[model samples]
Target: MNVDELILVSIDDHVVEPADMFKNHLPANLADQAPHVETDASGVDRWIYQGRVTGVSGLNAVVTWPPEEWAKDPAGFAEMRPAVYDIHDRVRDMDRNGILASMCFPTFAGFSAGHLNHFKDPLTVIMIQAYNDWHIDEWAGTYPGRFIPLALLPTWDPQLMVAEIRRVAAKGCRAVTMPELPHLEGLPSYHDITYWGPVFAALSETGLVMCLHIGTGFGALKLAPDAPIDNLIILA
Candidate 1:
């Protein structure tokens, strides 16, 4: 077998959160406050969350187009693979690629779902919890062993993050997506032993791995302002 063709485990794939997630999971009282989609003046659909907006970065939704298209400009929802947004279709694609297991990070929710912290308390907590519930019950459940389940902690508060870690661990989640370099964005850095004490405590007990995805690390791509996308991706 060609070893490259036999790639089986993809630990850093991502999923586009379904638009109706909040509608399906949030109670009527809080559903209206949940992040919803809207096409902007430019006609691109973006997630509007508590005054912060995020659009699909071409990098994350990269399978359906030529590299030039996906790696250069931002791709709207229409440009992504149906599999990138649908669990059933995703499994079919995974099977086709011989991917026995995959772990998906959040798209609109940001790498660790850390971007959601920009919103107020309680609501943000509810939103993150809802995302995890939907991820496990809906997404991963669709393929069971074919998809490894990972959760995102509220990185702003270590104690609360620890609690979430334990909670998700109890629910069978074995990994979490986190910021690669936390201090760069004002969150506690990985080197801060005291800050991550509770987090390590919970994970040490549950044996979960802390997964760090790019884009949540120290700074954005260090490319010249006028550099071509190809050059940046090449450097990356």
Candidate 2:
């Protein structure tokens, strides 16, 4: 088979979320607390939530950069191609690559939303649902079958996670991203039946897949912070 004839479906692509994701989704009361991007004096953009920076790296969206330019991540969204955040452009990019469909994980939201655990309760759940709405209702919904809907769960609370699983499944989400090692994130481990039982049950009942992505529960390999990222990719 020729390379040009081989169609592809990427299950692990990612989206550099748009800046106004929470703008129309969140309620007026939570607007002030919703996550937003702020650019520092150096013009480096970071996701800030409730007065704290989420500390997400830009490497997640560096694919659009030239090979030599990928050594370091783009400092801000301004440095990325519109396809990194725009669904319309993303579909076109997929077409160019012969990708029939793609499932995009969240970016600043953390692979499994562990970064959101620092925030308070209902607010965290709210933010997650809002993100899901943008991802499911707008992002994937806009292009129909061209994309797979992947939702983020508030894993800090198992009950909340179950509710979110059901909610997003109703919204047409086929899967939810979860931390590979919940215990490392200060949550109960998979062995803790009491903690994960209901959550697992909810996922099974709703028929939504639970996607445990690497590096979500902390880095998969214990490499130094300054180590070359290529090492992790090659080794992983």
Candidate 3:
């Protein structure tokens, strides 16, 4: 093949995340507490995780809507693209756009289960594993090479985190979404290699990459402490 004909790859792609992701993957005993799809009192469809509302509504599906509407306003499933959650539809869109592969990070699950930190432990850990299972088995396993499965683990305890990393590493996950600014999120600093030695070692042995997306630890960009998100987004 000619160099000009090389396939384009999107290393930082993301998933809108279907509402039933955790529900379908979690154990029956814990499934009810998992995230689920529900329409808010305002009639907006959203993913409710442990009773907390999450995600950017239809932001991930903007391409499926009229350029004028979704770019500014929140939208529901009906108003957005089915391809955002459906793997088959996503592949078609990638084909149309000439993308051969994508490494999709999580939406509501945070940059790499960072959102799970807001909840309590134990169950929080379970949910992270659930999301990883769903990502690997259903997402990547379903479509093969079209998408890369990015897993997230419980990062509160270094020991448990290492174990979880090894567990997923054995499952063929090539990359794991991580928090770049852990200290900002009330966790240890990235310089604390003493606690992170095991993490790096496992990743090195398994050949897994630490993929950190923006806003995983905290706000990625905030021009003003109290400024409106709009100002920061536009100005930044």
Please give the CA lDDT of all the candidate structures: 0.79, 0.82, 0.75
Q: Quick one: best TM-score, which candidate?
A: 2
Which pairs of residues have clashing backbones in candidate 3?
A: none
Q: Cα miss at 160, model 2 (Å)? A: 1.3
Number of the candidate with higher lDDT, 2 or 3 = 2
Q: Per-residue lDDT tens digits of candidate 3, residues 1-236? A: 78656788899777778766776677788877777777778777766677777754434556645544534344677765777777888898889888899999777677767667678578888888888888898988888888877889787778777877888888888888888788767777779998778888888888888987765433555356655444533542
Per-residue CA lDDT of candidate 2, range 1-236, in tens? 79898999999888888889888898898898889988888778889987878643566777756655555443687677889888888898899999999999887888888777667488888888899999998899998998889998888777888888888888889999988888778778899999899999999999998888776534445667776767556664
Q: Estimated TM-score per prediction?
A: 0.91, 0.93, 0.86
Who wins the lDDT comparison?
A: 2
**Model 1 C-alpha lDDT per residue in residues 63-113, reported as the tens digit of each score:** 856766646355577867888888888888988888889999888888878
Which segments of candidate 1 are over 4 A away from where they belong? 1-7, 218-221
